[model samples]
Target: MLKFFVVTGIGLALLNGWIIWWLWRALEHTGWLRPMLCLVVAVLGVSFPLLYKLGGDSAIEVWLLRAGSFWLGMLFYVFMLVLIMDIWGLASRLWAEPPVAPRWGGALLVMGLPLVIGCASWFNAANPIVREYDLTISTNDPVPQTYAQSPLILGVLADMHLGRIITAPRLVRAMDLLAPYKPDAVLYIGDIIDDHILVDVEGMAAALARVEPRLGHWVVPGNHEYISGSIKDSLDILRHSGMQVLRDQWRILDNAFVLVGRDDMSRHAFEGTPRKSLPEILADIPHAHRNLPIFVMDHQPSMLDEARTAGAVLELSGHTHFGQLWPFHWVVESMYENPMGLLIKNGLHSVVSPGVGTWGPPMRNTSRAEVLIVKVHFTQTAQ
Candidate 1:
């Protein structure tokens, strides 16, 4: 259905271009510089699809998609209004004369220059993501350390669609910013690489190694981990960089804390179904371990009800890049019951980030790529 509209639109635009070429020659006798004017506009109008496709993999693509969707329609309406004014001026010219070349030329340049410049600015920006989050615990749980002290923090920067565009500089800059907080544990949420982590496996690994957290670094595989080559390769890259690859297992710290790492929700089975339900995941927590504080690492944050019911402390997730565009941002918000923020239900807390990297286009449109620094306080009261 989508391809149908795409093809039809492009085809008609091409047809329109051909007609404009013929019209340009015809308009020469009417004092219209049709060859110089309408020819350029018509060519641009016809090849808009090509421009859209080219922009899809770059930073400007994000902004262009928005302007193409919303502002483009607005421009069309404005163009129609201007055409009416031009008609009236032509009628007036039959009686008197007005300056033709300077007024209209200046007006067109003024209107068009800013749109082009706006796109150019975004295109030249070195990095699209600007990471920001306020890390604070729910002031309800009395888990010992409150906001009064610098809490032993755990951070997860996930779903970085770090491809050809988001290079080591962006990743390095992220580490430099995060290092100031001095986290105890840092986790790469998933999708360390876009299609193939191996494409820049060595470089990404070096960057991950530079991420100096005091206690440890952990990584849970995302769906993108399995794309292209073997999943083992992606896991190996993460592991080589001093990260523990927790796959479908729980790590217990003494008797007080447990971090359960589940397989990517998109990858339903590794060996067997084993009940393949939220209840099953809850059941996976050993009976003796149930009372301990729990944190969950899952790819997409599915099965929210079970996580809450089981008294999971916090569940961190990425994958929804927070619409990444204007109109699409509305759709992304509607897709989630809680949207993109902190949601705690039945004493279970969840934080879904806009993510630090992009997937479809290399650039971000509406939501800037972010590195989440969530501070979970174990407080006695809301202070």
Candidate 2:
């Protein structure tokens, strides 16, 4: 906990420092611009976090705080772009006189670009595009010929981050998109609730109750479930809503495949529950089921080798929203071998979804919001 606090302190300090420096360059004029820049810096860098923590739980107050955070994040990116252009203009003037434009033209350009881009991003996030993948998890081991009799269509939705941005209407849209597939089972990889905001637990449960499949509706907790020490509370709510909450447990589906759900890595850090090792979880599954094709639901892209070693043929995961924004996906790419797609390594297949809801900005700049409609076949290859 001490380490966490120290790291958080350092990060906030650095972020505030950068905001101050950026404001200084972007608004150098002394008259009214000085106060305006100071206000912007205060609101964008410091006030949002502080207010978010202290704000009341009333719907009005929550919306105010959320809106402040969203627009500030959007404007921050705009400020960076505009500041870069300004620096380039100044550098060019050192070598040759630059073409003159109206004083207000620069201001409009700086403000207009972010406004246009921000609106588009908001629309894109509000309307998520369906992304589908057809994969075959093949194995050389002796398998049931009955598995080839039919394909298992599994629908996966992850990282809903519900509370502020992901409301019932948005969730309904995702359900509507996945309905056509008529999946036999739906596995929800967690973050179903937003940690920082006050959520209507009953309302969320009611909305989720609408999503029913023929076989089962399963869910695994993500890092957000442990947020604010609400893991157990959250689990109870969802369980009451007809979801089979699987925490380090496995369930057989149609006698053809075994579904294993792992507790999020944060269980120890946040919930004080020690997570079971992959081998321990695998030991419980009958040997006959092992060869029948194992599909594991791990929330994050960790413990790949352990799952593979345990004979898991497929793993479904989320938590890297493919960076959930532009240029940031580059950073996410460096972190995970398969950030957002189907990856097969040594016969272990992993599919990581980009997630269905927004996290911070409520805007997906380049990253798409999607649910995975995966067709799992026990065949020789991806064909």
Candidate 3:
């Protein structure tokens, strides 16, 4: 961990230096503007994380974090653009004179594009979509006659980073979107709250009370739950809000299927609770449920293979936000076999939601915030 942090710190410092260098070049002609911009950049680059971790009570602090998160999100893309421009400029020197210094107009455009994209992303994040999928789990036994007419409809939601950005209205909007599906059960994959500000926990109970998943409602802890440093409080809040919290446990749902929820991959990192291995959890399954379709709820997609190996027919997860931002999702996609959608490998099915809510900047670019209505059908095949 120390080595990881050291490397990360050095990488960020270099990125910041380059960004500052670009800014200086672009605004050099503006006199005092360059120094002032530099100071602002330095302060934000240094203090945003501190402020975000400390959180705040004042409106200024809230907006500061919001703005800081927005800028940070934009910074990566802007840095890439600036690097490209710098490379292009350097290469042109061999063919022609080092294209004269950039004009103010050009600089402004370079800066403005990222902000434009950020604003558009903000709007996109506010409007979430409901993505639906129909899945069939073939088994040795036929789907019970009782549920054949009504295949268990499951509503899967994850990464609802409910904080200042995702307020009551957004929660209401998600509820409204999922209500039409009339899910038999709704599962919250995790990250219910971004942080534990006093205001965050206030209306949570009331807000969650409005969610109506017909059969049952469940949640598994996500990294944010522990990172917020309020695991106990978060659990209490979620329970009060009417969702069953499941951690490394399995619940038999009307004997029709088994719902296995795992702890977030970062549980030990943040909370010191080592997660149970897939084999261990599967070993505890009752003999009666051994042949039943088992659906695993894991907060992160990293544990996909384990769940599949455990003979789980389906696995539901979130935490990727499917790259929530353009190019970023590309990074996320490279990391997982199933980053944002369904993946079928050797008959094991995995569905990863881009997330119904978002994290950082209240923005999404390459992906849309989504609630998934998964219709699970149990079918029997003759050997």
Candidate 4:
């Protein structure tokens, strides 16, 4: 992981340098501006790395990663900017026209890219996207025996990505907002830790323990948990803080509602750590419970078909982060089921929360970081 940061930063710096060189060479006839640009590149060449070490990213090494990422994007923009300008200049010279504004504008835009990205540091450091998520969930799962006319309030939060850049403030607002729901229970879908994740796990544990719900609080792992090199430690904190960490298990409530959960499917793909399979869990489910209405709490909702076949009435999961930004939402829609909100298939209902918080960039566009407040009303149809 550390190597990833270093390599990423260095790679961007080199790429930026190359782009500057090409840009400078492209306009030798432009005189001092070309040399001046080269000089600027040389300064950035040395400074970006230094900035990376000082700040990277999160509170841990965010300064480095953020700085590196900014420069990387900057270089990419400049490279493309220059390349675009080169083509534009050629077309203009051939057809008789002054350089299009896009050329100079592109260069200027590249120059501002770092500043634009720089705001991300403070935005994440401040906004944190912590909000009250309150929902009443009522399930008629004969298995969990969760059959009730009243709503079961489920407080849900997910994907903090706390590490270097994040701080206590993030947790502070989260707790504050989450307090309102008077949640019967709280659910953390996954990705609780990252580079700038709060290191005071004990403190965080103590705080979360204070968040009393009617039934219980449960959590599941996300991709970042493994990436942060603190999966065991994180689960320990949750357990100590009084949260149930589900790994291929189901908790029956009201003899009807069931919260069946499994380890992140990606765990094996990324960490080479074998996770408990869904079949194993389904096998463990009591036969009586199987036919009852069940509400699952899996991480990703991609397993819609499998979940339906297994007889999950309502499955709640959060991993997509709802794209976290604008254009990405369009692309993310193609990836996850319903990305956010209720999605029903074959009498199997799945609600994918936009998530409690965001991952990288900490920016909200199409859908903001949020806690899901689900209101489940049990409806009994034929089997």
Off by over 4 Å in 1: 1-150, 268-279, 282-288, 379-383
After superposing candidate 4 on the true structure, give the runs of residues whose Cα lies further than 4 Å from its correct spot. Answer: 1-87, 94-106, 113-149, 196-198, 270-274
Candidate 1 lDDT, 1-383, residue by residue in tens = 35765886776565445434434533555555655666555544533344444435445653444334333322333344345545665777886876233244534543355345435433433244434444343434345432346554766687776544455566665665566666667867777665441246566667766767755777777877755246777687667656788776677743335777767765544323432444455576777766666677776666677677766777887777676544467887777755566776777778777677655444445655667666554444445
Local distance difference test, per candidate? 0.59, 0.74, 0.80, 0.64
RMSD of 4: 5.2
**What local lDDT score does residue 296 receive in model 3, on the 0 to 100 scale?**
92
Off by over 4 Å in 3: 1-10, 31-36, 92-99, 271-273
Candidate 2 wrongly placed segments (more than 4 Å): 1-41, 44-47, 89-104, 139-149, 379-383
* lDDT for position 218 in model 1: 74
Listed in order, each prediction's TM-score against the native is 0.64, 0.85, 0.91, 0.75
Error of 3 at 162 (Å): 1.7
Per residue, candidate 4 scores C-alpha lDDT tens digits across 124-195 of: 434534343233333333312242456566777777665554444566567667777677778878776664
Q: Is candidate 2 or candidate 3 better by lDDT?
A: 3
